[model samples]
Target: MIRAAAKNHKDVLVVVDSQDYPRLLEFLQGNQDDQEFRMMLAWKAFQHSGLYDCAVSEWLWKQPTVGGEYPLSFAVPLSLKSSLRYGENPHQTAAVYVDKRLSEVNAGGIASAIQHHGKEMSFNNYLDADAAWNCVRDFNNPTCVIVKHTNPCGVASRDDIIEAYRLAVKADPVSAFLGYTASTIVDPVGGVGGIWLIWDPTQVSVSAHIANSQLIQATVKRENFKEWVLAAVYASPNPGIRQNLWNDLENTSSLMVRPWLIAGTILPIS
Candidate 1:
């Protein structure tokens, strides 16, 4: 009716907000050409209608047949989580909504995540990140799950979480770089390029530890800084210290390379 009156070039008075009662009375007295006031009311009317329609649709979706999927009359009310910059595409306006009950106690899910850094997450990012989180959480060991378009591109669980991540990235490097990655265990021993060396501190001791803006290296040793096995590498993105990082890696590799064999009783973790 509001659009029809506007199209017909007639004076239209839309009432969607009770606060506008004063304005409506003023317009009734002598202001009929109040296009701005009418337009504002029209906008509110449309937004309210859209939300009501969404609620009705959700309620109807819950209705089930005698033996069909949906069960009975009920409502599934969702509260907004956030307004996204864009939805599945730029053309659509979108917001993420969550079930408040689930979100309240969600300790580690994406819905309850507190981002430490990075640009605003998109709708698709939430979907893919949630997928990666779900998959990675299922494993007890160190695991990496890479999800693209809400599907797993790479997933690996290993005795070594770093090795698991390496295998996952090797499984599909291009996709791994583009998609969301969720890792269950990241070795606290930091290294270069956001990389980490994951090791069992109970089985070995740290002989020497090294860290630069670009990398971190730790020499794994026997009982008390004795002979060792191998060195772990993590490279940072800082190009300012490339030469220093390379020299350190080379020196460590050349000086620490040694052949070691292991033969031991194996007990598997469930």
Candidate 2:
């Protein structure tokens, strides 16, 4: 109506009753060029034809059931866990929350993952890690699953962790760089360019214990700390230096570590 009035270069008048007059007046405030017509045409028509009363009576008769009759009409209980570093992108803000009922039944999922190493986990990292972890956990043998944008790009199972990794990478070599790997063992010597590591600490128990001590010492000795942007620890470390390791890494490195505790086990990785 406003556009038509502007195009025709003429004033437009709107007719409304007392009930709708205020709203119409507010809408046409700056645009009004003529006086408004006030009339209760609708009310007079309904009074004579009884259309409004019949419609109201029909609506009341067909009213839907509520509360007790429809148990699905209930609110879910949720508790805010923590704020994520950012959402899928840096400009957006996001947070993690847990459903009270679901968390009680499945307590070992991503909602309980701790940050033990790099920067705070981003929303995308949590999603990718969750996907990779779920796939790797399903296999009994040594398995490697690489996830990118919440989809598995490469997945393979073998007796040997290294062979499994190689086979997984062979699935899609090009996408391997832009993905996060969930595996029993990740070769640290491999190019760490775009590949993010989500390693199981239990798989490298012996070496992880030694690496824990070495990592602390390396942090102390090296003047330049390398940043592993996408690396996450999804398994618990040795109990002896758990606190010490977390403190040292927090103090020394620019990298973020996510310490996950699953089924009463603390998974610490750097």
- Estimate the Cα RMSD of every predicted model relative to the unseen true structure: 14.1, 19.0
Which residue pairs in model 1 clash with each other?
64-70, 192-215, 192-216, 192-234, 192-235, 192-236, 193-235, 193-236, 214-236
Clashes of 1: 9
lDDT of 2 by residue, 58-166 (tens): 4554567522433432334356888986787666899988755565676657767667886577789889999998989999999999777889999999999999998
Off by over 4 Å in 2: 1-71, 100-108, 137-140, 178-270
| Tens digits of lDDT, candidate 1, 4-117 | 543443355666668889977887898447777767777766665556776777666656633346545544546677888667875567887765656667663886677798
CA lDDT of every candidate: 0.61, 0.53
| Candidate No. with top TM-score | 1
lDDT of 2 at 129: 90
Q: For model 1, what is the alpha-carbon lDDT of residue 224? A: 62
